[model samples]
Target: MRNMRLAAALALVFILVTTVFLGGCGQKLAVAPQQGGLQGLKKLKVGLVFDVGGRGDKSFNDAAYEGLEKAEKEFGDKIEIKYLEPSAGGENRERLLRLMAQDKYDLIFGVGFIFTDSIAKVAKEFPQIKFGLIDGFVPGLKAENNISCLLFREHEGSFLVGAAAAMQSKTGKIGFVGGMQSPLIEKFETGYIAGAKYINPNIGILSDYIGTASDAFKDPVKGKELTLKQIKDGADVIYHASGASGIGVLEAAASQQKFVIGVDSDQSLPAKEDQRSFVLTSMLKRVDVAVYETIRSLVTQKFQGGYQEFGVQENGVGYAENQYNKELIAANKAKLDELKEKIIMGEIKVPTSKEDLK
Candidate 1:
């Protein structure tokens, strides 16, 4: 009987140990790749090069990071991912693209329009490598049938912010500060002005562009100066499509105790708690979602080339729902929601280019 009891205890110990081990194994298997899916797709290497703002802007760059993170999580062991931050004067873009091509990455994504010329040039040289360009396009550039372009309907989101600004403004005057006067930046400004006019034709707008694309988006000092000037000119609300330079606009707004709208992402989250008071809302452009979706298509062998647009119709861009400032006028929210539904239902069409504006 003693021998039997000892044997039983040993058996119980073995069972408990096996159960623990198996439980852990099960957890690992849950996340493990399936027999023939993306799990089996090995030797996959991907690289992403960010545009001028780099990662900390908490707007465009951050969104792109989120998409890359999603790709990392889903692809797991089958893929290796890397990112490059370009320096001033676009010095790093060509070097990094060349390095990525030399490294034989399976896919490379260039994050902004600044890379249009570089990518167009590099893609032609590295014909066998697959490339994804975001926010810009390279016409007549062919890369071994492996290049794709991703564009966004930024004007669509800008329109929403314009409406929001118009409804929320205590003063009828508003301002738009663009990083550069490119056709792309004008898309945002034109859509915004149209939206404001849609609400009230008499709404006054002060618009200015910061000069060159590279300098326009990074000059916080200039952004601040322009924003203050607008405020003094009777503009109570301001919208900035100026990338990192928009930081100055937000700072100026906070200093002046005025309201400011953001672009690309929810700036309130990144702003200091005190500064957040002036951030009324953000025009959220899900560039990250676009990046992730494009990568996902490649992972799943569903990559589609040509132009892809993200808009309110695709849930790609919109205004933040006043999470930080719950005290927004109820009527304003209601009106915005009504307009959103109309836009979604085809009763209202948001402009895509400046030419679309009436």
Candidate 2:
């Protein structure tokens, strides 16, 4: 009887263990059911492909991430948000985008102008998938129905900061550091110089381009090198249109006891303790607003495609005047507002190219 009882106890333990093990395996294999919204519509899935300087750049890429986060907050479980940062250049972007499409993402966004060609190609291949391309519009592409291009009046905002730099400079010299010498970056240079000259007819403006390649946007060491050169050349104030590379410019300013203007987003918020004090102001490019609006449109089924340009008149670009730099910009507020009015009123033509400035 004792042997029989012991045998029964061992059999029960074995049965319990097998049951628990199979239950665990079952849970692991289970998939969450597809969720729906008010009208039983499926949840929205969004995929974002960030350029080289992804979320932590504290500049352009961060702004885009903010927009995505905003959308996720608003929709909650009704949406799925995913972002991809390419390990390499062009081909990687193409692969990431293609994979997102293959996964049937309801919407996708490419964060920079660098993705223009890759997005154009992938977007055309996936005609049914909605795509948003920031900072660039592919020319001669007929995928307008499915792709939306978001562009900015970077020059207009650059002009405002340029005026501020001219007014605030103690050395009668200011400088511009651009990521590349492309036409897009040239717009920033032209407008900056023009606005500076408009403020002080005799102001000396020094300009430098980081490089001719896309990688220039990510090269801060080179940015620091160029900024030091400009400072040595007597520039007490500088503005940079370079992306992540601009961080170096700000660092150099703090080290050299000069002033630096930020680009894209309000950069003062991300600057280190010492660097924040030297950031005179920033050219506020409303990339975050554009990105959020695009996602909102997709959510509401009101998505529009084709080339869309956001400008000063649309409040798409302007100067940053937060607590970090409000006191610094106060002295130039009246004149800056007047210049802003002229640009919006069509009285002042903000040059978008070097030739236009001439």
Candidate 3:
């Protein structure tokens, strides 16, 4: 009977050991999934709203998207990105921004100045969210702490490209096609005219706007019509800062066998063979670089809110020189380089408005 009791006691001890070991194994399995779940929760959410031309315009909007894409590739699963293109009227812009903010997105960006008012309204309501405005500033917006304005010295870059146009023009007359007549676009117009005059005092400049509204940026029909008008008026080389509308300018230039300068991205890179032949160069606005850097700052917890101005001195803007425009730029390399240095050194002041140009 004592031997039997000893065996039973030994069996009881074995059961207890097995239970403890099995419990530990279960806990280990559960802990791994929980740890992984916690890691997955750490992703940062980002939202972007494109301007009128949207992402495929291969112009300003595409540049912004490129920045987002770059950040996504580098961070991988660490970040979640979403972008929206508002209706042509942009009546949905405010709603889109609010939805993103309500969903607790970490950072949101508005791609054009047209969004300034909408962003300001939503940003005020959601003080916890971070907002970025490109080529746009909401003057006197109360949410200064949560908003950052990214602006560029477009005039400085325009000046460089305009000089190239002047030098490349077969005819003494050139043209400037603008998206709108606002102070913002006026900067581009004045700079182009100033740079042309800097090269040749008597150069004729034919300037026209696609329209008087924000939609002008995407109006290729108007872009083509205006460009044709300029070409008819003896303008052989054209410089356009009209976003997607500039594509039409390129088309017109090619059709007419004239030269053209593009804006924002390296327009020459995406041009068709016919268009490529006429694309002299593009004003590199560095919008993608700016957007990427801003998002990086946010991810690293180093983001600062306020006005951030990028200029030629900051490498924020310049002219693109690629295979399509290499020979053209090479011919004017010395003059263009000299003008760039002068602008950076403050020896040359590129006007930012029609009034300023006067």
Candidate 4:
């Protein structure tokens, strides 16, 4: 009886060990690979959320999408891309965050300053998930180990446009149409005015901040009305940094037979083939470049979480070469070329803020 009892005890121990081993093996098989070595066997899922303007604006959101598309092409089986376009005042911010968390996305990116608050809250709730935020800063909010903040020196690019506008304007008067009166929008205005003055101190600037922070960039009717008034004020060239609302500014410029400067992307391309005459130039923000670089960094395990700013020094922002303007202003092209070289060479600094204006 003692021998039989000992044998049973040994048998039970063996069975328990086998069961634990098999269970552990199964769990290991279920867990996805966490590093780049298994990229071929598994895909890294990524999600993006666009702000109120959404896609088809041919500007900010579209530029970000371009980067995401590039990643899909380059990473192949290594990545899967997903996106969300929030409707006006969309409450899906938290919903999207929850979806990303539940779906086990490897990384998620949020576009626009408006989503800063949402990102902050989501980042806190999911400490294990990684995130990227564009165009805004949250102070004292400790982004988890997996979060990164990307910012652009829009003022730097805007300054160059301002200088170009002042130099190219047949009319001494120039105007600015900003979508919102927030600090971000003001950055564009401050840099532009400073750049204009740098070129010609006497240039008359007609500036108007269309609406308060919340409503400023969304009101197309106000954009058109403000732009029309600027045209009537004898401003032949106007710079618009008003998101989708800038479309109205472009239309107004076309109707008035005046030149308009575009923001974020190559707006000149969006203008009708015949209406191309109205777009003098566009400020290239290179949001696509930033997004692409960030993704590449993650793939390479070079992800640095904090703040990064892109500027002319990094070739991250500038003005598109005005192919049309070059032909029209053939005689003046040399001056523009000289100015570009000077700015690039650091001989001439382009002012991009109110402090830089003087």
Question: What are the clash counts of all predictions, listed in order?
Answer: 0, 0, 0, 1
| Cα TM-score of candidate 2 | 0.87
RMSD of each: 9.0, 9.4, 3.7, 5.7
Give per-residue lDDT, candidate 2, residue 276.
87
Q: TM-score for each prediction?
A: 0.85, 0.87, 0.89, 0.84
Kindly report which residue pairs in candidate 1 clash with one another: none
Per-residue CA lDDT of candidate 3, range 245-277, in tens?
Answer: 998999998999988898899998889976797
Off by over 4 Å in 2: 1-41, 88-91, 140-144
Off by over 4 Å in 4: 1-40, 140-144, 328-352, 355-358
Candidate 3 accuracy as TM-score = 0.89
Tell how far residue 340 is off in model 3, in angstroms: 1.1
82-158: candidate 2 lDDT, tens digit per residue: 99988844358889999999999978999888788888888889888999999887775443488889999888988
Backbone clashes (count) for model 2: 0
Mark the regions of model 1 whose C-alpha exceeds 4 Å error after superposition: 1-43, 140-144, 353-355
Model 1 — TM-score against the truth? Answer: 0.85
lDDT of 1: 0.83
lDDT of 1 by residue, 1-358 (tens): 9999999999999999999999999887776655554547565888999877788867677888888998899887667899988887557888899899999987899988888888778877987777888888877543235678888777777887898888878889999999877888888898798788889889998998877657577788999999999999999999999888899999999999989998888888889988998888888898878888888887777776666778788888888866686565355777777777777788878776666775
